[model samples]
Target chain A: MAEFKKADSMLEWFDQRLGVVNFVKVMMTEYWIPKNINFLWAMGVLLTVLFTFLVVSGIFLLMYYKPDVNMAFDSVNYTIMQEVAYGWLFRHIHAVGASVVFLVIYIHMFTGIYYGSYKKGREMIWVSGMLLFMLFSAEGFSGYMLPWGQMSYWAAYVITEIFGGIPVIGDELVVWIRGNFYVSDSTLTRFFMLHVLLIPLAIIGAIVFHFYALRFPHVNNEEGEFFDFDEEAKKYLAGNKKESKVVPFWPVFLSKDFFVLGFFMLFFFYLVFFHYNFAMDPVNFDKADGLKTPAHIYPEWYFLWSYEVLRGFFFEIAGVSGKDLGLMAFGFANAIFLVLPWLDRSPMVKPANQRPYFKYWFWFLMADLIVLTVYGKLPPTGANAWVGFASSMTFLALFIALPFITKAEAKKVGGK
Target chain B: MKEFKILAVIAALVGITYYGIEPYAHHIMHPEVAPADFSFKTLKNVDTTLAGNAENGKVLVEANCIACHAIDKAGYPAIMPNADAAASYGVVPPDLSSSGRIYDKNYLANFIFDPVSAMHLEGKYTPESGKQFPMPAYNWMSPQEIMDIVAYLQSVTPKVTEGKETNKATFEAACGRCHDMKYAGIQATTPKDNLKAYMGATPPDLSQYIKSRGEHYLHSFVNDPQVLLHGTSMPRVGLTEKAQEEVIAYMEEIGDSKKAERESLGIWVMLYTFVFAILAYLWKRKIWSEVH
Candidate 1:
């Protein structure tokens, strides 16, 4: 009660009793962030806000969406679009929000990579973030099924069929995932549960851990130097008038975060209200049909790089099934990203501009990813497959050769 | 102040861009109407009250339809060779087995009165092109006689061996003459190029028609093709109400069989998410307010 001596109002009285005021001050208001980071830093906060929007809008859609094969198409087209009040708005937001969320996350990830944010003590943060990315993929795939459109049905079939390429229990595994001999009622029901409940809960848990890991490391800056928060606090306590390199989370970073969020929202709301089908496929308007597969079957754009890698390796290696190997290659592509911290043996954790060789390699990887994404969208035939193969090889080589390449570059440049 | 101004400009640009392009994008995404020249009213006003016995309908189908159509599941060895039929009429007549299930009875009766008018192909083709009007007008037949034929077709349901039934037999009997079934792994007996030359447009494979058009649209279109899209070579395959329902059921079985289960579980999912969202909102507000 003595702590309440400075309490000035009724709200302060409740804060004194709850101690939530202290918790907030410690976690947010008093927290120090580097002032040198750019707008890329805002993507993490934007992703969180977008994820919230997705979940809320998704809930509204789930209210009217039918996951059954027969009614699923009609429910979305007739019931949601034509019947429910403002259902079109929610549906468009959820659909388009998915692509925008992935765009933000990709930028956030590239920002981490470009600045070596995954180095040293922040490995756990990187791991948690990668896990969240994996969960996001799972969430996206499962949500794609809820529509039960032509694309949804065929994509599920093709992806599940990939499991059947395994050697011993492949057929059984496919059946296990599908919950039946084919992608049917049981499959749709199971995927619905996973999309709406299971994967989202997992994403929330992963996000909490990601933030927790992030808290210890603070944030990586352009200089790649450790920030001392205690020294900054001491300066503030002593009534120093000089400008500090470290800024408070509130007002400083908060204003910038809000500004960026508002800008992003303007664009997002435009897409939702005006160009809602910007990234959607027209063929998906039709209902699911197992007997008739669409000419081209592909996952969302975020997954295209890995999907292209899988398609590139569509040939038998020795006696192993090419399909199985392709699936393995795809999984390995994603797994490599999770272990990037250990893969690079360089002692210095400088920004890309300071590390010339590292910068070139990073840009090469980005180019490779872009090539794969484009190739994945095109028909996998003749020259396209060969190009995809070359890009896939380059992608693997970049990760595998990173340590040696960086080590050699360090020796040539003389140690920093 | 600089940051504020930049943000204000960005906001203004977004608003301007949104308002400027919104109407055009809307027009593209959802066109105001179907193309002008391809318009025809649905047979919503056609009378469908006439009822006919399946047994009598069977006799009528044997007397009139058997010459051009195979009414049974075993559709091969049709009375006229498909090539000769295609050469003579510009489009080979479809089999009649599944017509009852895939069309509306009212549309079936109206289409029977004038085949060329029902399909809007009165002068779309000429004899010099070897693409004359395909189906002969059967307006002389009474509405009850057509209804009987439809009833008979409806009675010939595909045998369901298990929970699922294949539409192979139904599709082959009805759509095999003009359209190929190659996508579904069934080979076409007629030469595709000749059929295409005769019909003008290659009849699309019907294997995925159920998935594409849906049951409601399929019913209307199948009853009278011209009503949905003008100047198509597809003749109205006049079928009874019961027959159309059966065909739609067959299509559904082959296509979206799990639709019922998918729709039924949506409500619970919505309720759960709603409760979770409210709790999440409260938690976010509480946590976020600490910084404020």
Candidate 2:
């Protein structure tokens, strides 16, 4: 047998009761990862590191955070940032982590799609990861309300008001979610609970699910080549290391992860200290005023693309109201991501690099999302409105065109 | 190199979004106000070339200012207490100790000549039926005497810290009479209704004005409120160039208290992270070499 770690008596005693050594073998030492995967694969682990940063910093912020409408703004702005020692550091870490985590997530999501990691039997991995993202987004929206600032209050108000657009029980559902006619103390307190306790627990569960799902299908290689892991792992254990296409997950894989993580920390903390203001909206510095609405309101940049999709249907088409059409389109945009594995019908294993049309589609989709995000921030007036309409249409059109393009590619390859 | 290409794209996108687009969007949304004038050029001129002796200025301050304004650092208390003064004039006349440094010298000289026109409160502070301002125009006083009073005020003032504290005191001197900074525990010296009676409405509580209005907006608005919000009751406070900077610094401090700490710690954290990343790269190379 190939020895992973030489065990002593103390380890042996624990190993007998807990199956500690075997557990490590199954999870890490014996778990084989393809060697060809590049640093793009490391985005998943970077997200985990960022999540840990958020949780640790969030716990510190929780110590001083007061959820009451009267006290919430001051508690965050004064009690934590000014009064408590080193509190600013923790707040910075949490605030910056919230925004920076999204960058890694988009990278991970795109990397999966790019290499067709979401294809074959790996759909569960992508789905579970997407679940975590939705949960994280929920967490962000809820946590934003706890600050009780002008933007936080107004953003919560605008977002919850969207639920009232649902067909039948829409207005009642809005009342149920907010627990009032408008966003009030009940809404704030409930969101505080979700942000802190409930959603975080869901995220943790989703993280475990995501990781476990990846175990069966294995991490997809850069070129989407699937060789037998057992044979290559045996070769690695027998010391014909260069010939093996797999590496032990513990020492070999984790070392590389740590290197990526170290570089990520360089980027993350640079933002935490030097450029934290980007994460903190200046309008939110003022206390929440219920009577007066801010002149201009835009969601944070991460949500801007999706938000623009919701706003893009500017004209009435057929019988539907523009808002209802926009709302339906927005819903379509969000739900489309979940079905990506099924939508792509390519016989070609890797989606990019080899496939010419898919490569162009990927870049076009990326450029479209960026355009949507930019237009989302600008006022929807004159030509800016038309640009948003076209971009959002393109976002949907790309996905609708995906199956046709991939089917043609499959026929060209002369495969199922 | 591919990673660097990704990094460059990310940097470019963020740079475009934050530096380019955000400002451009703001400009489109908010009407562009004229830039602030610290020199008091908007006001009618007061020739500051007229030199005055400190000894002469001290006598003028005693005669003209001490009736309602206190020179506490100079051992002159107001003859009327603050409550009585507030009862008489809609707002209590501010103490004159720091006026030499905080208020523009030209503004001080001209304000003494005509209090009504100097503050741009011509309609409100005029000699109307029981609505006249308490501090009457000292237009009868000569220009030299007004400069002397300013010099005397400068002499008697306690030393204010150059940047932060001076700026804070300047904010208090210029803005505290009409505005409330609840975040900083500063309530307006003039009561809300009193200010409403005097200026048509109570000005906003300015606790987070630095954040809501932003630096550029605040600079222009504070220098001349009429420029941005035409017909605004808020008068141009006529602060000196240094005093204007001090006022902005004070607002920034209240709004972003951790700015100094964040800035100071940034370089060290960056250095540590860079070194750690370098070590990790070295370790990664070493570990990969064994596999090869």
Docking class of 2: medium
Q: Which stretches of candidate 2 lie over 4 Å from their true place?
A: A1-8, B1-33, B52-68, B73-76, B79-84, B112-165, B196-217, B228-232, B252-255
Best by lDDT: 2
Error of 2 at A15 (Å): 0.5
lDDT of 1 by residue, B190-250 (tens): 6677777766666765544665665656867765576666667776555444444555665
DockQ of each: 0.04, 0.54
Backbone clashes, candidate 2: 1
Error of 1 at B243 (Å): 30
Please give, for residues A46-82, the per-residue lDDT of candidate 2 as tens digits: 9888999899999999999999888998898889888
Model 1 DockQ, alpha carbons vs. true complex: 0.04
Q: List TM-score per model, in order.
A: 0.63, 0.91
Q: Ten-residue segment with the worst summed lDDT in candidate 1 chain A?
A: A236-245
Native-to-model Cα distance after best TM-score fit, residue A369 in candidate 1, in Å: 0.5
C-alpha lDDT (0 to 100) for residue B113 of candidate 1: 63
TM-score of 1: 0.63
